[model samples]
Target: MMDQPATSRTIDTQCVVAGSGPGGLMLGLLLARAGVDVTVVEKHADFLRDFRGDTVHPSTLDIIDQLGLLEELLKVPHTQAPRLHAEIGGRDVTIADFSRLPTKCRFIAFMPQWDFLDFLAREARKLPNFHIVMSAEVTDLIEDGGRIAGLVARTPDGSVEIRAPLVVGADGRNSVVRAKAGLEVESFGAPSDVLWMKLSHQPDDPPYTMGHGGPRQGFVMVDRGDYWQCGYVVRKGSFAEVKEKGIEAFREAVAAVSPLPADRVGEIRSWDEVHLLSIRIDRLKSWWRPGLLCIGDAAHAMSPIGGFGVNLAIQDAVAAANILSVPLREDRLADRYLAAVEKRRAFPTKATQKLQLMMQSSSKKRQESATKRSGPPSFVRGIARWPFLAHLTGRLVGLGIRSEKVNMAALKAR
Candidate 1:
């Protein structure tokens, strides 16, 4: 039955989770493991998209360990980072260090997001009650008597109505579920946008990862084994000016801050190869309405700083499963149960976003200042000066402000 495509006119499940992302799939997996019937719907046929967040922080690693899947997850090929490095005004400095985190794996595992998604799908499929419908785009919410009763998704064959008492919107930043649910978003503007492209790594390149930021420009280099996943930052809404400057100038800008050989920038032959991510920092005024709930990026969108987006989303999933699994299993799920998730996760979400906003604003100010040869930013230099500061930042980035642990009850449910 799992092999069959979603062609039925109506499907029933205890919980309907939209989007097959880290948050959605994790929530679906946890709920299913808790003996609840769960369905996760993905708009895409496969998780092969590039430039997605791939950083698996220690918080998530600890959660996997609690689930007893840490050994299995480590088998997948990935690069581990115990400490974060950055170049501030041409001077190298160590920033966050995850080595001291109180987790089974103290380092971040950088794996391609597609592989991670595939792994979750495989594990979830092992459960008899879990189902994932791919290429099924959610078109609208099925609202009944002022409460969300289910969702309507358009599949390859046709449309199908998934009925459930609770609908979990784990979709991404531009969430159709939240939009259809009439949730209001409070948008905090971003100062810059990012252009992501890949460049081949030379044998002689530095052995470790480093982030580069200069006057009015910033760059990032992630070691993707054979190549480097590079990101070039430009002032918000400046990509048009970048294009007008010609691809050669764009290549030069990338070469300016990065330690990689200038010749490697030529690999980015055209603008089409580059992906632009317009950074957004915002959260919904309310994460749930009646029978519907929004978690992950659907509830709040975080900045790319510290690679916290995916980790925070997974935190939401862990907390959701912990708070709602029991009530859901008892057929007593209520709006208060959904609201509890938001209440529990709201602090970490707000605190993380605040930190990102502060850093982004500070960076913008430094870039706009007349000081040309500034060393590391004051905070970063402080981190470099005080080793404990690095540990503190590491804990914040790796473990988050409030990390959720997997509930034993949920794990033992059968």
Candidate 2:
């Protein structure tokens, strides 16, 4: 036969999660572990992307412990950040001390986002009821009787239709599920965008540094064992201007604020190496409808401040599993059960976004003010002065406003 027509398939599950990000994968695992039939659809073939959020906070580590995957996760190559550091106002200061957190691992583990995703996928694959369909982009939501019933996904091979009682739009900020479902989003605009690139890490480099920015520039470089995952912040809608200035000029700007020597900055030899993350902070006006719910960035897009985005997304998955598992398994997934997930997560989401906005505002004001003083804001300076404040910052950054625990009831339901 010279050619043959591609085939189509239909899958039926109790819940279908779109997107294989932290939120989607974690939710699939939790639901499957609870004896709920679940499927996670991902548009990508592999989780090999660079410069995604890599900080796994203590809160997430505790959740992993609850799932009995902590030892395995810790076995992966990572850097432990018990104390977060930053260069503020030309002074290196310890910002958050995770050493005091009340968790099994009182530190933020700096692991590549790919490794983390792969770990979750691997663990989820071990579950009999957990199904992951990679390279399947969810194109549209399937509706019946005025409620979302399933979704249509397009794969390279053919078309795949997944039928489920609940559709989770964990597909991230530009979620097709949420868009198709006609959910309203309230945007809290971001002040800047980030240019992400990698620089070779030298043996003599600082062990663990977080941010390096001044009045004219903003940069964050996290130690990634052999390399530095760098993010250069530019004013919103300014990447074009940066490109017009040429790559050399951009490299100079990076060098100006980089803790690395000038030679290391040259690694960014071309514009292709720089990835621009157009930051957006927004949340859905409502996180759910009758038979569908949205979690993680699908519900609230978070700024990269504090590297809280990944942790918060995973938290949403945990909360979703806790609140909706039984309801979904028992065929009682009413609107209230979906709404309960939102109610459970809304406070921490709002509080985290508010804190990020406040920090962004403070940075913007400091950059615009005509004051001679050129250090971090007064509160940050106070944090440096008081050791206990670092602990407080650690709790806020590591544990979040309200960290979630895996509901044992959901786990035991299997």
Candidate 3:
């Protein structure tokens, strides 16, 4: 029980998880399956938001099959593409081929992120111990002797306090929980920011469902079936420059690189339709303090280079659940356990960030010397030439450096 004075303002549970994104929801769901009393608080009222991380990579699909949620989750609306393609020098080049990935599903499922989250949320709610509080935004950390014990949040009803043995910060990039806890983040600055928008896709449009990337000139288009989810990567802090060029010029630029008709770009209409994401490639140097631990986007903010951001977040959640659930249930959450979770995940996080930094460095080079810049670099084309190497690329993209397996062995099913 909480040592705080008896007050109705406080709600106690075994674990209090913040944020309802992929990582947050996944951690909560797995923890609940491990028979832990967990409460997930989300500031958003619903999961029906336009999310850019729509590619559910093969590794994540493998995890779903493990939980026996694959059949049911696949019942939701989604599209699948076996191979990821990119347009290089006007040639359709295969980047990461998922067709040969040895898994239950050898394709990336392109579903609305909301549908993915809702499916997980519905499954989570089936457990009596799992409770979700929506429209609840965490305002500050609840500390005792410099140790984080819980959090203070503003709910629709009133400001309430949640006290738990462990308080997990799974909030996004600008995590209030991470900030309030005084954790430090190290930055590996991104070379570009993403301008996300949607335009109606026509039957005559390019049939490449994996999307296209043209050096630094074109926008990446994913086939979301009805409306194409398009994102233009502008040199960091270049949105205003793009905006000042006039919408017509911007439309022409998009059409020059993408397969979309010039008139289709006009559907974007004005600058207001363009959503600017100040891309950040950073991660917390330290992920915890005492009774608090962080996972997912809270600990590391990834660049959307390979659509591995969401997959990485989900992997963090899986690793966290594997390590923390048992300790949390038995009331043995120590600083070392938190450190172990960090240690287990640190390698994958850094390795992925290292790859992203290399991409950013190359992008900066392309920006400085336009003459030297062309279609995708030589290595990207080299993989497509060799059939065997393309499959290896699929293995890396589909599975990642270290694929985490779920271990819920210590608790009884509720």
Off by over 4 Å in 3: 1-8, 210-215, 384-387, 411-414
Tens-digit lDDT string for candidate 3 (1-414) = 111222348888999999988899999999989988898988878887774687788999998998988999999989887887777666777777888777889988888988998888999988888988887889998888877888888876778898898999999899999999999999888778888888897888887864445566546778888888888878888899998999888878777766677778889888888788889989999998899998887999988756778888899999988888888887888899899999999999899888878767866776677676666544565765765676777887788878888884644533
Candidate 3 residue-wise lDDT at 215: 60
Instruction: Encode model 1's per-residue lDDT on 208-259: one tens digit a residue.
Output: 6767765677788888999999888888999999999999988888888887
Candidate 1 yields a Cα-based lDDT of 0.88
TM-score of each: 0.97, 0.96, 0.95
Q: Over all chains combined, what TM-score does candidate 1 have?
A: 0.97
Q: What are the lDDT scores of the predictions, listed in order?
A: 0.88, 0.87, 0.82
Ranking by lDDT: 1, 2, 3
Q: Please report, as a residue range, the 10-residue window in candidate 3 with the lowest summed lDDT.
A: 1-10
Candidate 3 global TM-score: 0.95
Candidate 2: misplaced stretches above 4 Å? 1-8, 370-373, 377-379
C-alpha RMSD values across all candidates: 1.5, 2.9, 3.2
- The alpha-carbon deviation from the true structure for residue 5 of candidate 3, after best TM-score superposition, in angstroms, is 20
Q: Which candidate should be chosen as best, given lDDT against the real structure?
A: 1
lDDT of 2 by residue, 298-385 (tens): 9999998688889899999999999888988888888888888899999999999998888888767776772655655556778878
Which of candidates 1 and 2 reaches a greater TM-score?
1
